[model samples]
Target: MTLLSLSGVSFAYAAGKTVLHGIDLAVRDGGNLGIVGESGSGKTTLLKLLLGLERASAGTVSFRGAPLDARDRGFMLGFRRSVQAVFQDPYSSLDPRQRVSDIVAEPLRSLKIGTDIAEAVAQALRDVDLPPDAAGRYPHEFSGGQRQRIAIARAIVARPALIVADEVVSALDLTTRTRIIDLMRALSTRTTFVVVSHDIALVALLCERLVVLEKGRIVEEGATREILARPSHPYTQRLLASTPRMPARG
Candidate 1:
């Protein structure tokens, strides 16, 4: 079953520059997919299109076979509640003025879910393995890793069915990155994820399927093992070659 799909989607900037051209992609329900390419490969633009943050220049974006449109108000609201996102910069994505609890509760409050905001906030913090007392602190009070964890907590508190993690771990340290990746995998039991990144090796480690984009189009896609072991496209090979190998451990 396809949970989210982009069929013949295309998008262009106001300057008349095309970013994505005739792209087609589908993510199976509960599957983890990684979209990888160099900068300016239209990966982020594709994410925006998926989120409906930007409209498609052509073609259609459907969620569970239903087209996302204003007429589908109830469906759009449900979809928004079901599909969440965690962006690249945790520090910037969070509001500096808001306390951790408030930040996590914003969605619940906005959506008028009628749940106890305090309890929902507490549960979200606990799910992310954050200390209960941690909720009282502001975003400035936490380290980079902790901040990213807070971001993750906020994304999951809504109990979203699908998550678009756009380079969520790109700026973290190796240890922190590994922990977040593991957290993401654990979270996948409840939600599907679309992880977009430039690091082929990291994507290989975290995702089951890989889609390699080049100049706004998909050049290669396959099982992670197949693409990593035997890349067919020159662009895919270049990305593989450019990826640094991890040091061997004794």
Candidate 2:
């Protein structure tokens, strides 16, 4: 079953420059998928379409088989609760003024998903392997890895069905990156993820399926293992060659 999908979608900026071509994609329910591409490959624009932040210029972006309608309060409320996102820079993604507790609880307050926001915040902190005391601290108090974990905790605090992670670990160091990847791997058992990254290797660690985007169109897509072993497209081959291969999931 598909939770969110883009059918023949396209997008262009006001300058009349097309960023994405006719594109078709689906995010299967409870499954992890990766959208991989070089910079300016339309990957970020596609993520915006999936998140319903930007409307498609040509085709449909659907949630659960119905067109995504931002004006429909009933539909949008549900969509907001069902899909959540974690962006690239943990340092900038978080509010410097908000305490960790309030930061994590923002979704609960905005979406009104749970009654006990405090307990939910604490539980989310636990899920991310942070100490309970960490919640009372500000964003400046933690290391980069810890800050990213806080961001992840906030994303999962609502127990949303799907998470769209966009270049989530790109800003972290190598040692920190591995630990966060491991944390996400553990979290994947209970939540579906759509990971967007320039690194084939990072997405290979998280996504069961892979979609390659180049110049605003899909160049190739298939099971991650199959694509890793035998890439059929020149663009995809280059992506694989550019990144060190991470150990595949068993």
Candidate 3:
């Protein structure tokens, strides 16, 4: 079943300059979709629209066939609980002063999911392979990969149906990047993921389908194999060419 759908979506900044036009995309339940494009391609904007952080200038964005409007407090709260976001920078996204447990428990408190705050935080840390004691430590104590794992754990703590992972692994080192990607793949068995990234190979490794964007338009999209093996669109080809190659395993 389709968990999220965007139809004929268009968005423009003030002064009538359109950034996205006639965009249509659907993400199935538990689907891993990777959206790739150059810096100005509106990938992040699409994510904002999905998260209800920004409304579409035109067209509609829906979840479970129902429109997503942040004005409805009930729906907004429910959406926030069911749909979560793990931002690009873990260090920036988290509060430096707060302990790890409080950071993970913030969503539950805000959404008022349940009273078992301690249990929720503990299970979340464990789900991401973080030690129970790690919950008491601050963000500074963990490495980059570990911090990102905490971020992911925070996203899923409420049992969100969909998680918008915006560049969740981009800032990590190559070794950390691979490990985090593996962790994400393992986690997707339960929660849906919309992985926003510009790295073709990273997306190729993680996503089931690919959406190639250029200048705010979807230039091409298809199964991961087709897009990677023979990228038809010029923009897609450029993205693939620009990727830094990692040494093949022996």
Tell me, by lDDT, which candidate is best.
2
lDDT of 2 at 23: 93
Candidate 3 TM-score, C-alpha based: 0.96
lDDT scores of the candidates, listed in order: 0.87, 0.93, 0.88
lDDT (Cα) of model 2? 0.93
TM-score of 1: 0.95
Clashes of each: 0, 0, 0
Over 52-96, each residue of candidate 3 has an lDDT whose tens digit, in order, gives: 899999999998898998789998888898899999998788899
Worst 10 residues of 1 by lDDT: 241-250
Provide the RMSD of all predictions against the true structure, rounded to 1 decimal.
2.5, 0.9, 2.2
Q: Residue 177 of model 3: what lDDT?
A: 90
| Clashing pairs in model 2, backbone N/Cα/C closer than 3 A | none
What clash pairs does model 3 have?
Answer: none
Winning model by TM-score = 2
- Sort order, TM-score high to low: 2, 3, 1
